[model samples]
Target: MTAGPYPPSMIGLSDVPVSNLAPPTGALVALAVAQFAAISWLGRRCEPALATDRWRRFLDDGNAPLMTVYLWHLPAMVLLVGAGLLLPDLILPDAGLHWWLIRPLWLANCALILVVLTRLWHRFETVRLPALGTRTGPATALAGTGLAAASIWYLWQHGATLNGAGSAGRIAAVLALGCSLVLLACGQPRTRRDAPVRGPELNVHPVRSGPAA
Candidate 1:
């Protein structure tokens, strides 16, 4: 099937004007099959203990900041693209061995930019809103969620642009983000201080002598 031009550096494809070109189906199929087979083989070969407690902790740490990464990765990429366009001499002119060598450097640059921006933007991702109480009921929550969902749908339908006909898309994105904040503000779990506490419970436990004495 035909495919549009994507970042050649990211996919390890040769520099070519791919806007009107279609990649070979056999090549795509082979790549897909190779990936699947490799993954399957690794999954079966690796021991379960490979995921130790330390590994799990590392995974958790990586996952914790992933929301920030996800939010800003696209923006970072856009910035990088803009930079490449502006600084053609420093970034362009890659050919033969130089082009291949620069690929890893370009990837590293993108990753470094992403990491730095993600750290800077991390606070916005962790914004906590006020907890929902009796005043803000489920109806309010539902309304906020509905509004957010509609906003997201509008943006998705409009291609997430703000130029030309996308001014309306920008409005939708704003509304969506606002509704999302509302949902988040009222979505926190109520602590015992906020919620009514039930009466104390009574229980009986049998005491045992140390090893039957």
Candidate 2:
């Protein structure tokens, strides 16, 4: 006899054995770690370039816009994807085109979403909070959390398959990935703040008598 919807041996699904899923690609993980390390090192080495007073002030004041971009891009991607699917005939014609072309169209849609979201977020005060002193830690944490939560929610809604037992595990994985990126970006040095300036003591010279005569 032929097997039913499920195999005859798998009558009781709960008792059936499940195969282990393969872990994520090691090559991608290694490349990401290397990229983060390189960026961190570059930022630290470039920190001295921002030593000038004016540029330092600007760097200290410009954290808000940067954070705003970091926080909204992923959610915007999801929105664009949904919009593209809903309006496929307009955004991407359903004519006799090669299937591979759809990938580039999807990328363009995502880029458009990113640009729109970044511009909108830049107008908000909360998105542009300063990154300096004690507030830096909290602000970084908050931004990281926001990005992570948004990514996880988006992935869950879109039904991305994961090795997780349920939604909680999938969310945790996405959040971890988002947090990693935030930490990496935060650790980068602000190159705009670097500027050379003479010290106050060097600028002033002691008045001396002519040959002490």
Candidate 3:
């Protein structure tokens, strides 16, 4: 539901009906405040549990690879859903039948492909400047940041149109952008000879004679 000139599509998951009826401003404000308060209470209650070792590790592990999932999940889902739509008889299960058997396999397939792609593209997210003091370092970082931002914007704008001719191009562009960002941030790999070396230390100890003068 939406207020003013906005459509129900734009509002996303509202209590208001799909009809043209507009809720009062006071009611909208009250609902929003109530929602916020509920969220705050939930967060406070969950904080301690979320901070425990198990939860902490789960969050860390999930977060480490979440960027890859976020980046590729849409395309993967689109491809899978498109296939199911194109050949429903061959790919998708009948309504309310065999879904339990097919769903797990479908989910696993998606997860496997995503994991492979994530591994392949992981370097970009882990990019680190070899030397921040170098002129190239700052420039590379800036360029990488800009490219990453552009890729995100492109995805956000064109995500719904994944079935179009431009979908492959969009995927390729994002992949290239991610790789280029890594190259810029990481620079050239350092050789073994270039690694810092520590020289051996010399020690001197005074010797005492049998009978000191």
Top candidate when judged by TM-score against the true structure: 1
Residue 66 Cα positional deviation in candidate 3, in Å, after optimal superposition: 1.3
36-154: candidate 3 lDDT, tens digit per residue:
99999999999988988999999898899887789987677677888789878756867666776788888987887778778888778778635722234566777777777777777
| lDDT values for all models | 0.70, 0.63, 0.70
Over all chains combined, what TM-score does candidate 1 have? 0.58
Q: TM-score for model 3?
A: 0.40
Stretches of model 2 off by over 4 angstroms after superposition: 1-25, 53-62, 86-112, 119-213
For model 1, what is the C-alpha lDDT against the true structure? 0.70
**194: Cα error in model 1, Å:** 9.1
Ranking 1 against 2 by TM-score, winner: 1
Please report how far candidate 3 places residue 196 from its true position, in Å.
19
Global Cα lDDT for candidate 3:
0.70
**Alpha carbon lDDT of residue 69, candidate 2?**
65
lDDT of 2 by residue, 30-112 (tens): 65799999999988988788787987889877764677768887798778767768777765565556445676877776778
lDDT of 1 by residue, 1-213 (tens): 334333233232235433222443445566689999999988777648557888788778888898888888888878887888987766765577766777888888889999999888787778885456434557767777777877777764554556775597677687677977666466455567887878888796997668753
Q: For residue 131, give model 3's deviation from the true position in Å.
A: 6.0
Clashes of each: 0, 9, 0
